[model samples]
Target chain A: MTDPKRPRDPDPLADDAFDAALGARLRAGREDTATLSAAVLSRLAQDPRQTPPGRWLTPAPMAAGFAGLMTVAGVAGYLWVPLFGAGGEDAILAAALGGLVPGGF
Target chain B: MTAEARAKGASEAMDALMRGDRLALSRLIALYGPGIRAFAAHQLGDASEAEDIAQEVFLRVWSEARRYDPARGAVSTWIWRIAANLCTDRRRRRAVRRFLGLEAVPEAALPDDAMPGAERIVAGREQMRQLGPALAALPDRQREALLMRTAGELATAEIAAAMGLSPGAVEQLLVRARAGLRRTMGEKDDD
Candidate 1:
């Protein structure tokens, strides 16, 4: 229930003019020529379309697909390979078991 | 690519960026930097600082785009926050300078009106100096709520998305922020 017509407090943004002035000064300097600013921008864009490395590649499905492939490859290697001791001291069961369920000697 | 296709192409480009496509990042900047700079100019309130801040924001965006989560916020809002954060940091640095007594008050902001140009700037300066504390005193959410409302020209829904507030909450925040500003500025009274 405050007075709608009275000066509410003192205008917190009354100094918006100061920010406006700062904006004005900055723009005034640019008014003479846009060439320098343009050049500066161009310098920043020296490699206009060159993407830097380690960025997320938008074709994200490829990265996902690659991950899937790695997973499959690992499982296949586990299932298909004959990774066992040539000197058969109960090696077949041992390799198949992979350090699990000790083979009876 | 047609216009829609071009945008789709850009979406793919962003994906490529996500895929570690080094050039996509640069392409994205080339496409969006100017617009970002223009917005930054207005948002930061000065071009000299705006340019540097814009560059810093974009670099941070590039470095962190991978962390962007749609569930958390819109990509645009994420970028906006980077820019806003940089501006706020600059403000903090300036405040620190002023705090150490190293910040000299510009003569134009002083009370004495000796010269015409100085006199003009003085009024503006004095008004701002007076207003600064009040503006600073406002709740951060209220102040940022106002900035979000004005700067982005965003609808309440969009503001809600960017700020992670409910739309209703955003509207209420805006109401309070405006009322707060009005109260602080003495809009209820005049000299």
Candidate 2:
């Protein structure tokens, strides 16, 4: 939306003088040299931009993928790792029973 | 985007800000942050208070950035208006504290060296101290109008919009602000 009240440009001399006054104020706002302003800039840069350290096991995407893989691995481990002493390929077949049941022999 | 990029860049940045892009928000903060800080610092006569106000201003920007529309004014102007409003609010609160005879004012005004690094803050503070008397001597309206205009680098139009005055009034205020500033600094021209 338009502001509907933007100022008309000032006359040339007025504009120049205005600029000069402002320049002084801005320059005056400047402090020391080189690494002068630790206070304000430090404060300004304190936003959470990216790669936030601490908390959560991973970025949410990776964590979700990891959880899925871990679940599948846990199921495979349970089937193959001799539950009730049902070791070896028998256990493997039982674990794989969801598919490839190979009809009538 | 340079000027070459500013149009495309600003448009994209505007969209990014609306979409809550953190980087865009940071850019917007940087664009107008210093001006806001300066205005706050000058208004409160203390850098610590100014920094506090600056952070508040940015937080408000982060929250309200989605509402900003580039067609109205540059993001810079829009943000400064927010900052100015916040500073004015704080000034009111300060007045209340002072009235209660309970607010213990700081011994010396904080220096504007609130920016990062330790470079020239001392010199800057010295200048502020040297100019403090001069700055205090001006009529309130002239001082505020000059500081708000120059420190923010606001064009007269944006200044008018922020101050709620006619552009003609702004021009008059600005002219008086400059003359007052020159007189405050003990400068005189033959012409």
Candidate 3:
């Protein structure tokens, strides 16, 4: 473990004072955070916490949903090919005229 | 307050929060909010985004109280980890927005206009003028380590836990970060 007291830099230009001053400046920013704290608390009051979501939204469920969707699309495509493929004259006519005609062609 | 007192308070607040005392959330916020905001502002160079990250961090604490494992680390460490992760995520989103032309590239210097009144005064100082961009220019890990130490009040070991780095690595990063900032600020002076 690196000892916090040990000087790691041999460079004469390394200004430990400057770094400490910078750290102080950074810490100085802390005083102005009352507005932030109030804002957070106000937001907390506005939005009540809900129970944590279980594994319902995990990748496994998402993947299963995708598989279900793909299965649906595949079944649709399989049925669609038999009706609307190049050999299905009636299917093509019906698709072309179905919207315009009261009954499908 | 002393560090020990602050840690004890934070621990008590976390326990209260876990016990469904919503008011304890305010105490936790009062304790950790400033450090998280400071760390986020310095790391992202955007005050508005820093506020958002700070708010989100507390919200997560409220909603995810069950996830807190005291055996692993202190409440401060856990909260700092949340803040750091949110800042990292926000920075990544900013980069993606820039890449997609939805957001402009951030200026090297900090945005004084968007900064809070006090931060503006600090940024307005002549010597401190270049510090922001010099800080922004440091390597991401180095900047994160330094900000956690300075702004987040995280010890080397706490930073290591938050950042998933060894304590030695965190110390090296701090050393290099200060060196890099000095060089960059010096160059700005030369120019």
iRMSD (1 decimal) for each model: 10.2, 7.7, 4.2
For candidate 1, the per-residue lDDT at B166 reads 90
Compared with the true structure, what per-residue lDDT tens digits does model 3 show for residues B61-101? 98899889999998988998888877776776677778899
- On the 0 to 100 scale, the lDDT of residue B44 in model 3 is 79
lDDT tens digits by residue: candidate 1, A1-104: 88888765535364344334433322222222233234434544675344433233323646897999999999976665545434454565666677565553
lDDT of 1 at A55: 31
Q: For each candidate, what's the DockQ?
A: 0.03, 0.08, 0.28
Q: Which of the two, 1 or 3, has more lDDT? A: 3
State each model's TM-score restricted to chain B.
Answer: 0.56, 0.81, 0.87
Query: What are the per-residue Cα lDDT tens digits for candidate 3 across A1-105?
Result: 899999675653454455557766665545555676677677777767642242234446679989999999999877887774577866666688887888645
Here, model 2's chain A TM-score works out at: 0.25
- Per-candidate TM vs. native? 0.44, 0.60, 0.73
Off by over 4 Å in 3: A1-19, A50-105, B107-128
The digit string of per-residue lDDT tens for model 1 on B93-177 reads 6567789988653321112122248656566456645544444456766656555544333456756776678999977777676
Where does candidate 3 chain B have its weakest 10-residue lDDT segment?
A: B106-115
Stronger candidate by lDDT (2 vs 3): 3
